[model samples]
Target chain A: LAKTTQPISMDSYEGQEVNITCSHNNIATNDYITWYQQFPSQGPRFIIQGYKTKVTNEVASLFIPADRKSSTLSLPRVSLSDTAVYYCLVGNSMDTGRRALTFGSGTRLQVQP
Target chain B: EAGVAQSPRYKIIEKRQSVAFWCNPISGHATLYWYQQILGQGPKLLIQFQNNGVVDDSQLPKDRFSAERLKGVDSTLKIQPAKLEDSAVYLCASSPRTSGGTYEQYFGPGTRLTVT
Candidate 1:
C-alpha cells in the first residue's frame, strides 16, 4: 500500500468551493486514488474515486494528473453540512475483490456558516 | 436496502473488562471488514472476512481483539481485558465482490467503546 499525505485541516466558508490536495509521491502504477468522508461519530463514507485524469460524481470531482503523484478533491458550493474529515487513500483497494482501504489522519474540513 | 447494522452503539468498560459488538452486513455482501478509529484519527483496518473466512488480520492485536463472521452474514468483535488506549470506535463495513476496480463500501454507524 502506498502512503498518502494531506493537510491536517482546512477552513472554508459556505457556498465556497474547496479543493483539498493529497500527495502520494510513492504511488504505484496500478494504485487508485479514493476519497472518503466521515462526520462526527460516524464511519467513513466513500466520496469519489479515480484512476487518472478526472472523474466527477454528483457529490465531488477528482482530478489526477498524468504523473499520478498527486490528486485533488473538489467540493462545489460547500455547506455547513459538508464539514467533515476527508481522507485520501491510494491503493488498488478493489483488487482481488477486497476493498482494504488504508486511511490516514485525514484533512478536517470545517465549513463555517 | 438496509445498510450495515451495528450494536450496541456505545459501550463503556473498565480496564481488564470484556465487551462485544455485533454487526449485520447488507444482504448478499460477500466481504465484511472491521476497523478501529481512534479519536481524531482515521480508521485503521483490523480485520477482513470473505464469506466466513478470514482474508486478512495483520493489524489485529490478536492477544486482545478477536472477530468472527460465522455464516458470513452477521459478525461480532470482542475485546478481552480492554485497556485505556483501546478506547475507540469500532466500525463495520461491507462491500460486494466485483471484477472491476470499483471502490464502494457501505459502513455502519459503528460501536463507540470507552475503556476507562
Candidate 2:
C-alpha cells in the first residue's frame, strides 16, 4: 500500500478556490490517485481521478506532476455544499484485483458563509 | 439507474451479540466492496468481490467477520460475538470496472452499528 499524507483541515469561503494537496512519496509506478468527498452522515462520493498530468471535470480538477509523488484536488468557486471531508486514495486501478483502494487520513474542508 | 442500497440504516447491539448488514449493488456492476469507517477516520476496506468471487479480504478479521455475495448481485456482511470496537459505519460500494478499470465507485448510505 502506498502511504499518503494530507492536511487535516482547511478553511475557505464561498466562491473561493480550495486546493488540497496529498503526498505519496512511495507511490508505485502503476498507482493512480483518486479523490472522494464525504459529508456528515453520508457515504463518500467520487470527486476526481488522475494518473499523470491534469484531469478536469465539472466538479473538480486533479493535477498530478511528472514525478507523481504528490497530487492536488482543486475545487473551483466552492459553495457551502462543498464543505466535506476530502479523502485521497492511491492504488493500482489497472491491477484491479491485485491491490485494494486505500484512503489517507483525509482533509476536512470547512466552507464558511 | 439506482445506486447501491444498504439496509436497516442503523443498528445497536451489545458485546457478544450478532448482527448482519445487507447490500444490493447497481445492476450490471461487477465489482462490490465493503468498508468500515470509524469515527473521525477514513473508510477501511474489509472485502472486495468481483461478481460472485472474492478478490481481496486480507483486512477482514475472520474470527468474527464474514461477508458473501450471492449471484453476483447482492452482498451480506455479518459479525458474530461483536466487539465494542466494531461500532462503526459499514459502507457498501460498487463499480462497473470496465475492461480497463473505470475506477468509478458508487457508495450506499451505509449501516451504522453501535456495539455497546
Candidate 3:
C-alpha cells in the first residue's frame, strides 16, 4: 500500500473547474490510483481510476504524471451537489484474494454558490 | 441493478453491550468487505471475504469483533462488549469477480452505531 497526501480542504464556486492533487512518493509499479467521493451520511462512491497518463469518464478525469509519483482529479463545471470528501487510494489492484484498501483522511471539497 | 443492502440503518448500545449489523451484497458478487469509518476520518478495512472464506482480517480486533459471510451472500458483523470507541459507521461493499482483480466496489448505505 502506498501512502497518499492531499490537501485537507478546498473551496470552490459553482460552475468552476476544481482539481485535487494527491502525492504518493513511494508508489509501486503495480499500484493504481483510485478516487472516491462521499457525501455527509452516505458511503463513498467510486469516481475515477488510472494507472498512468490520463483517464476520463462521464464524471471526472484522472491525470497521472509520467513519474507516477502524483495524480490529480479534475472536476469540470462543479455544482453545489459535488461538495463532498474525496479520497485518493493507491494499491495493487491485481491482488484479488485480498484487496482491502487503506484510506486516509480525505480532502473535503466545499462547493459554494 | 439493486445495490448492496444493509439493515438497521442505526444502532445505539451501551459500552458493555453486544450489537450486530447485517449486510446483503449485490447478487453474484463474489467479494464482500466490512469497513469502519470514524467521524471525520476515512474508512478502514476490517475484514474481507472471498465467497464464504475469510481472506484478510488483520485489522479486526479479534477479541471483540467478529464477522461471517454465510452462503457467500449475506454477512453479519458482531461486537461483544462494545467499547465507546466503537462508535462509527459500518460499511459493507461488494465487487464482482473480474480479470486482473480490478473491479469497482459497490457500497451500501452504512449502519451507524453509537456506543454510549
Candidate 4:
C-alpha cells in the first residue's frame, strides 16, 4: 500500500470549482488512486477513481499525471451540500485475493455560501 | 439493489462489557469488510471476508474481537471486555468480485459504539 498525503482542510465558496490534490510519491505501477466522500454520520462513498491521465464522471473528475505520484479530484459547481471529508487511497487490485484499504486523515472540504 | 444493512445504529456500553453488531451486505456480493472509524479519523480496515472465509484479519485484535459470516451472507462482529479506546463507529461494507479487480464497495450506515 502506498502512503498518501493530502491537505487537512480546505474552504470553498458556492458555485466555485474545487480541486483537492493527493500526493503518493511512492505509488506503485499497479496501484490506482481512488477517492471517497464522507459526510457526518455516514459511511464513505466512492466518488471517482483513476490510474493515470484524466477520468471524468457525472459527479466529478480525476486527473492523474504521467508520474502517478500525485492526483487531483476536481469538483465543478460546488454547493453547500458538497461539504464533506474526502479521502485519497492508493491500492492495487485484489491480487492477494483480499482488499485492505489504508485511509489517511482525509481533507475536510467546507463549502460556504 | 439493496445496499448493505447494519443494526443498532447506536450503542453505549461501559468498559469491560461485551457488545455485538450485525451486518447484511448487498445481495450476491462475495466480499465483505469490517472497518472501525474513530472520531476525527478515517476508517481503518479491521477484517475482510470472502464468501465466509477469512481473507485478512491482520489488523483485528483477535483477543477481544471476533467476526463471523455464516453461509457466506450475514455477518456478526463481537467485542468482549471493551475499553474506552474501543469507542468508534463499526462500518460494514460489501463489494462484488469482478474480473477486472476493481469492485466498488457499498457501505451501510455504521453501528456507533461508545464504550463509556
Candidate 5:
C-alpha cells in the first residue's frame, strides 16, 4: 500500500467546480487511486476510482497522469449537500489483503450557498 | 438491492465493560469487512471475512475483540473490557468476490460506540 497526501481543507461556492488533488509519490504499478466521500455521522461512500488517464462517473471524475504519482478528483457544480470530507487511498489487490487504510486528515470541502 | 445493515446505531458503555455490534451484509456478498473509524480519521480495517471464514484480522485486538460470521450471512463483533480509546464508529462493508477491483463495496450506517 502507498501513502497519500492531500489538502487539509478547501472552500468553494455552490455551482463552482472543485478539484482536489492527492499525491502518492510512492505509488506502485498495481496501485489504484480511489476517492471516497464521508458526511457527518455516516460511513464513507465511494466517489470515483482510476488507474490512469481519466475516468468519469455520475458522481465525480478521477484524473491520473502518466506518472501516476498524483491523482485529482473533480467535482462539478458543487452544492451544499456536497460538503463533506474526502479521502484518497492507494492500494492494489482485489481485497488488498484487507489492509487497514491509514486516513490522514482528509480534505474538508465546504460548499457555500 | 439491500445495503449492509448494522445494529444499535449508538452505544454508550463504561470502560472495562463489554459491548457487541451486529452486521448483516448485502445479499450474496461473499466478502465482509469490519472497520473502526475514530473521530477525524478514516475507517480502519479491523477484520475481513470471506463468507463464514476469517480472512484477515491482523489489526484486531484478539485479546479483547472477537468477531464471527456464522452461516456466512450475518456477523457479530464483540469487545470485552472496552477502553476509552475504543470509542469510535464501527462500520461494516460488503462486496461480491467476483466483482473485481472496479467494483465498489457497500457500507452500512455503522455503530457509534462511546466508551466512557
Candidate 6:
C-alpha cells in the first residue's frame, strides 16, 4: 500500500473554495486516488475518485497531475455543513480485495461562517 | 436500496467483559467489511468477507476479536474480555461485487463501543 501524506488541518469560511492536497510519492502504476469525507459520529462518505488528469462530479473535483505522485481534492462553495475530515486513499481496485486500505490521519477542514 | 445497518448504536462495557456487535449489509451486496475507528484517527479494516467466506482478517486481533457472516448477509463481531483500548467506533460497510471492475463502498452508521 502506498503511504499518503496530507495536511493535519485546514480552515475556510463558508462559500469559500477549499483545496486539500495529498502526496503519495510511491504510488503504483495501477493505483487510483480516491477521496472520502467523514463527519463526526458518521462513517466516511465517498466524495470523488480519479486515476489521472481531472475529474469533476457534483460534490467535488479531483485534480491529478501528470506525475500522478500527488492529487488534490477541490471542494467548491463550501458551507458549514461541509465541515468534515477528508481522507485520500491510494490503491488499486484489484488490490482492495487482498489488502485493506491504509487511511491516513486525514485533513480536517473547518468550514466556518 | 437501504444502506448498511448496524445495531446497538452504542455499547458500554467494563474491561474483561464480553460484548457483541451486529451488522446487516445492504441487500445483495457480496462484500462486507468491518472497520475500527479510534477518536481523531481514520478507520482501520479489521476484517472482510466475500459472501459467507472470509477474505482477509490480517489486522484483526484474533485472540480477542472474532467476526462471522453466517448467511453472507448479516454479520456479528464479538470481543471476549474487552480492554480499555478497545473503546472506539466499529463501522460496517458493503460494496457491490467487483467481478468486472471497481465498485464504490457504502458505509453504515457505526456502533460506538466504550470500555471502562
Candidate 1, superposed: residue stretches over 4 Å from native: A94-99
Q: A49-68, model 4: which lDDT tens digit per residue?
A: 88889999999999999999
RMSD of 1: 1.6
lDDT of each: 0.90, 0.91, 0.91, 0.91, 0.88, 0.90
> Could you tell me which residue pairs clash in candidate 6?
none
| Per-residue lDDT of candidate 6, residues B13-116 (tens digit) | 99999999999999999989999999999999999898999888989999999999998889999999899999999999998886423457789999999999
In every candidate, what fraction of the native interface contacts is reproduced?
0.58, 0.52, 0.57, 0.53, 0.52, 0.55
Model 2 scores a TM of 0.96
lDDT of 3 by residue, A4-106 (tens): 9999999999999999999999987878899999998899999998889999999999999999999999999999999999999888646633343888899
lDDT of 4 at B54: 91
lDDT of 5 by residue, A1-113 (tens): 57789999999999999999999999877667888899998888988888899999998999999999999999999999999999998875464544425555689999999
Q: Is the docking of candidate 1 incorrect, acceptable, medium or high quality?
A: medium
i-RMSD per candidate, Å: 2.6, 2.2, 2.2, 2.2, 2.4, 2.2
- The 10-residue segment of model 1 chain B with minimum total lDDT is B96-105
Reference-based lDDT, residue B112, model 6: 99
Q: Which scores better on DockQ, 2 or 3? A: 3
- What DockQ, between 0 and 1, does each candidate earn? 0.58, 0.59, 0.61, 0.60, 0.57, 0.60
Give me the runs in candidate 3 sitting further than 4 Å from their true place.
Answer: A96-100
**Residue-wise C-alpha lDDT for candidate 4, range B3-84, written one tens digit per residue:** 8999999999999999999999999999899999999999998888999999889899999999999999999999998999
On lDDT, who's better, 3 or 5? 3
Model 1 Cα lDDT, one tens digit per residue, A1-113: 67899999999999999999999999877788889999998888989999999999999999999999999999999999999999998877455322347889999999999
Interface RMSD of 5: 2.4
How do the predictions measure up, each by TM-score? Answer: 0.96, 0.96, 0.97, 0.97, 0.94, 0.96
- State chain A's TM-score for model 6: 0.96
